[model samples]
Target: MSSNSTPYYFVPGLSRHPVMASIGLLGFGSGMTGLVNGYSWGAPLTIASVVYVLFVLYKWFGDAISESNSGQNSINVDVSYRWSMSWFIFSEIMFFAAFFSALFYARSISMPWLGDIESKLLWPTFTAVWPNDGPAGLVEQFSTMGPWPIPTINTLLLLSSGVTVTWAHHAIRENNQKHAVWGLAATVFLGAIFLGFQVYEYIHAYRDLNLKLTSGVYGSTFFMLTGFHGFHVFLGALMLAVVLRRAIRGDFTADNHFAFEGASWYWHFVDVVWLGLYVVIYWM
Candidate 1:
């Protein structure tokens, strides 16, 4: 493509990024499987695969940035990108929905059925209850996590991040680079602090509360929901940081900043998920 002429529909030449990303994902999947099944090489392989994946993403995104900066991305391409991001967020919604459904089934339907008059013959001592320890000493006794200082604080942090990210979006749209940078920086900082508090909460769960993955269905569900959400938060924060870098370099204009908008979409999604988790997992 020439610098003076813009294509009607921009399509770059074939690249190896797709295959490279696939290879990284394959390695990551294999490493995770090995780690779960107790292989000595699993840890190193997982770490290496993560680094490789990050490297691939850095290069892939760099290429896209260059293309955008070169005016290769047309309005059609922007629309396509927006549609892709919307679908991706929808997929994420379904992912969380499945977990939420499982929690509901376990708590409302299955628990009540098991504790009813019919199943008492099979397990006489069993009681259908929230945060159960399972039948016949199958699960370890552990205290439940409640809506307390740590969870409440994390909720406040994420809520604050949502506001800051919105502020950044508005700032970017108004071409206020300074406010945009500060807003993004604050969002990232809040996300980091939220993750830190989550780590402390996990430690407290293990060391003081005796709450672990082996504690019961409750423990597994709690960790799976919150852990995956935390991972999303990490990804969102990373995206914001990248956008922040771009903002500092004056890469975004009043009308041309899908990257910032996309990152904000994801950050808001993360914030919403945490709110659900706070209500269902902690308060309920």
Candidate 2:
């Protein structure tokens, strides 16, 4: 094939990766269901399935990387990848929307209805508050987390990481490998620090504040939002680390760096979601 000429679309041959991935996911799902139902080997099975899934992804994507590096990927292939990634992100947005909607319904509708005039006639002492001790005192009288020190610090860390990732992207565009590497390293470090603070915050919530996943509506929403977001942060950090590895190996150039760009997009999406969490979950 010519180095720079119009060419036929690239079509990858069928492989066993997809079947292996599906099997891994099935095992993971089965394990999760078993764990929820109190099976003895659930957790270990889940871990194993997770490891298998990761292995499959590494192998599958490694092939794609090899194809791209070999100049086998055409313009159509690049566009297809972009479209696929965009749709994937859109799906994620919808996932979070469902959770946020649940939070709204609980706080705005369910709580109010529970404490309404008719409800008071039935319960006699229930009060309608945003973060009350929940109906029948089922939830403990615990304090909610505020957007202070730890959360604020985490916010800063994520924001700074966003900036650093952007710097890395810019550096890559300019073909400044040294600056790009440093920027990616900084982003990874900041993401790790953010995760560390999150763990400490969770400990504080459980031990000091008496807040937990089972602590009623407030606790449930709190954990669901922040916990899922933390998981995303972890995934995003992992994606960045992979990109960094590729960069160190001189895989990206000014013209072909969608791997870096895709990871950056996911990281920025993560940052924005955290900002929303800070405002709605912590500050409000």
Predicted structure with the largest TM-score when compared to the true one: 1
> Where's the lowest-lDDT run of ten residues in candidate 1?
1-10
lDDT of 1 by residue, 1-284 (tens): 43323447788999999999999989998998787678998888988998998899999999999998888888788888899999999999999999999999999998998888988998999988897987777887899988899999999999999999999988988999999999999999999999999999999999999998767889989998998899899899999999999999999988889999998999999999999999999988
* Candidate 2 lDDT, 49-143, residue by residue in tens: 98999899899989988888888887778888888889988998998999999999998999999988888887898889889787687777898
lDDT of each: 0.91, 0.90
Instruction: Evaluate residue 98 in candidate 1 and report its C-alpha lDDT on the 0 to 100 scale.
Output: 100
| CA RMSD per model (angstroms) | 1.9, 1.7
Among residues 3 or more apart in sequence or in different chains, the pairs in candidate 2 whose N, CA or C atoms overlap within 3 Å are none
lDDT of 1 at 177: 96
Q: Say which candidate scores most in lDDT.
A: 1
